[model samples]
Target chain A: MKIIVSLFTFLICQLYTLAQVNQASMYGLDTSFLNYNTCELGAIHEYFSYHAKYPESTMSLLKRVQDSVVSHPIALSKNGFITFRFTVNCQGKASHFKLYLLDENYAETIFDKTLVLFLYDFIKGLNGWKIIKDKSGQHILNYNSYFSFQIKDGKIISVAP
Target chain B: MVKLYLWLLSLCLFCFNNSNASAQEVVVSKIDCLDSKWQESAEQGLFHAQYATGYMSEEWQSHCDSLLHICPNFSYIWEMKAMPHIKGGIYDFASLNKAVSINPNRQLPYRAFMKCIFSKDYYGALLDLDSAEQLVHGGGIMDHSFSFYKGISYLSIGKADSAVLYLQKDVAEQSKRMGLGNEHYNSLFYLGLAHLYAQQTKQAERYLLASIKAYSKFPEPNYYLGILYLQKNERLKAKTYFQMAQSALNNGYNMNEDNNIYVDYPFQISAVEIEQVLKE
Candidate 1:
């Protein structure tokens, strides 16, 4: 069991980037590049660089999503987390969305196509992202952010860090 | 000219990589940050590693990795390296296992804490906590008793009976040590949740109210109180509690757990839930 877990961890680390690439290809959906109207033209900063924040509380945003996004029960057989990694630019516009799905055990997996697409569209449509200022509060910065949805029995359980 | 540019770029990368390490080398002597359990070299490595640029950064991780290379048996470095992975929602048990193997008394509870809270692997947490209980004497980690986390894990995994047992033990121990009404608010909150799950509504309400009294701005107890009221078909009371929960959240009150910034706690509620309940 230990050996298997080690091997799994090794594979996950080695193929982490590849998994993102494959997610798009496997689903025939290119969530990789989104054309945002308000993105600044410069180097995209790391998330930890400026410690950017969302415009509203993450819980509020998630609550709104759970109430509205999953309009009907999805009969998908899988239960896991759907995480979207994206960039929010200086102008508070998010782009470059990448999706990663993992099971309760944290192993990578896929969910229903309709469900995944619905979530992808919902995240892409989300606005009012906030660009955090530097420590001196002078410069506006772009940063990467992750949005993850915990799912159980085809229902949206919660949003997480 | 092109070769000179390439050379300069390589030098810049090298400098960037070693910037934090160089800082460590300069100040490691004056810091006085040493863990007596490990060797001096390992302690120094950990101290220096802590001075790395930022957590989850390549430089910071590489600094830890380099330290591990020097002192492979150092559990702190392994734990440090595993943190980013855990917070990022990747459960790297191998590194955590390595840490536990080296120092079970110190790392087991930590691993259990991570499993219970961050990874939401309740069963796994219980296993580690059980082992930690065997190895260590009476103690706590991350500011709560081991039994507190065990209770939480059992509650999370739907074993309300076990959760209530452990949580009650935690409350008794805490009350005995710190005095009544002074146990950790989370303990009361989870006790309420466990009772609620077990259909023991009166007990649930008692503990939930105690939790609220302990920390009024805590949204979770208010939210669960809303659920309890709803279950009792008290719509107006439920709405009021839900509104309170919503208001608390809007005011930026959240679970005060140390790692709440990195992961959501079990039974955490959101504004939408409150709003939905209000609408109903």
Candidate 2:
């Protein structure tokens, strides 16, 4: 009887330990955290690689446009990331680009019109190519690229490589 | 004399029990009668008032009064009041806020959000939508409804891309579960709008047509079709679509009004733009 009671107690302790481990794993995940990590890494790689290869020629137009426009500073902790999805049209122009996963402040506070217009101008200067049919019968090169960005403290920290 | 007193006491007990039972039966009967009458009168007055003044009748006001007298905190009475305000185009943030305060757990927020949209307060509507979404987070029918409104709110704010994300999410997650019908129609309509705003013209046309096919009586698809035609520079076709939209609204087939419901950009293209397109 003593041995049987000891075995039962052992089994209960094991179950309790297993439950704790499971709960701990789940506690690490949330909608915001997961989105931040995935989007941040992807955007950093893409933006860094593109900026390196093309250098001044490709992004100069975007810089000019950004300078022309009035922009508010966006601040975020460097600890997290967000995933964005956007369309780059045939002209290497970004259209319909948006941050799908955003921090609460970015999502709720950023005006939609300001975001879209900024994206439109920035994307227009990207150096990429998408084939779209023009008024002529032949396909022509367009600068349409859609991708994500990892932004931290008003800086492009990372992009999809 | 002691025996006589005992007999009198027993007689009194018997009479008291009989009277109490009779009184209980009478109370039950009166309650049942009151319940049925109140419901019928309230429903009738609500319907008539909605039809006559584009609002609820003060005459039907008696039904609500009667109901409140009996059950002061009834949620349905407040909902009935909301219907008229919504229909009469007088639904404001204050009225809806009052309704929500009265019954936080009920579907008052949903109704109130609609009124907010009608009143052209997209920001207020979105705040209500956010609360409603949180309230119904477990992906039920109400969740689907809330998501649809959320998508609409995004669209109104000119975040077509965001609108598409939410609308498509609703379609993928909720529409399939709910099956193909009214919910499906609503999903398609919003999805079509998303595509249109994204400049996916062909896809927008297809989805909008499908929405109209799903519900022939719905006016939203027709209105959007007009916008689509305008985009394509097909002036005559756009005019026809606009006329169809107007006719549908006039015939009372349109469910939601308040033209600003879908207004997104700060500088909306004037109705004159439509007329100019038609003239061309």
Using Cα atoms, each model's DockQ against the true complex is 0.20, 0.01
- What's the residue-level lDDT of A8 in candidate 2? 100
True contacts kept of each: 0.13, 0.00
Q: Write the per-residue lDDT of candidate 1 for residues B179-204, one digit (tens) a residue.
A: 99998889999999999998999999
Predicted candidate 1 versus true structure: per-residue lDDT over A68-136, tens digit per residue: 755655555677777776777666766666667777666667788878877777776777666677668
- Residues B1-280 of candidate 2: C-alpha lDDT, one tens digit per residue: 4344333323332333355555444333433323545445445544554465433345344444444443445556656655443332223233344457766656556553553343334455577667766776633233346666667667756788888887777776755676655467667888898889989899789878878888776666777888899889887787887777656645646433233322111112223333443466
**Alpha-carbon TM-score of each model against the true structure:** 0.73, 0.42
- In Å, residue A70's CA in model 2 sits off its true spot by 23
Cα displacement (Å) at residue B17, model 1: 5.9
Per-residue lDDT, model 1, residue B69, is 49
Query: Cα deviation in Å at residue B145, candidate 1?
Result: 2.2
Every candidate's lDDT:
0.72, 0.48
DockQ, computed on Cα atoms, for candidate 2: 0.01
Model 2 misplaced regions, further than 4 Å: A1-161, B1-55, B92-98, B138-144, B173-175, B178-183, B215-275
Which portion of correct inter-chain contacts appears in model 2? Answer: 0.00
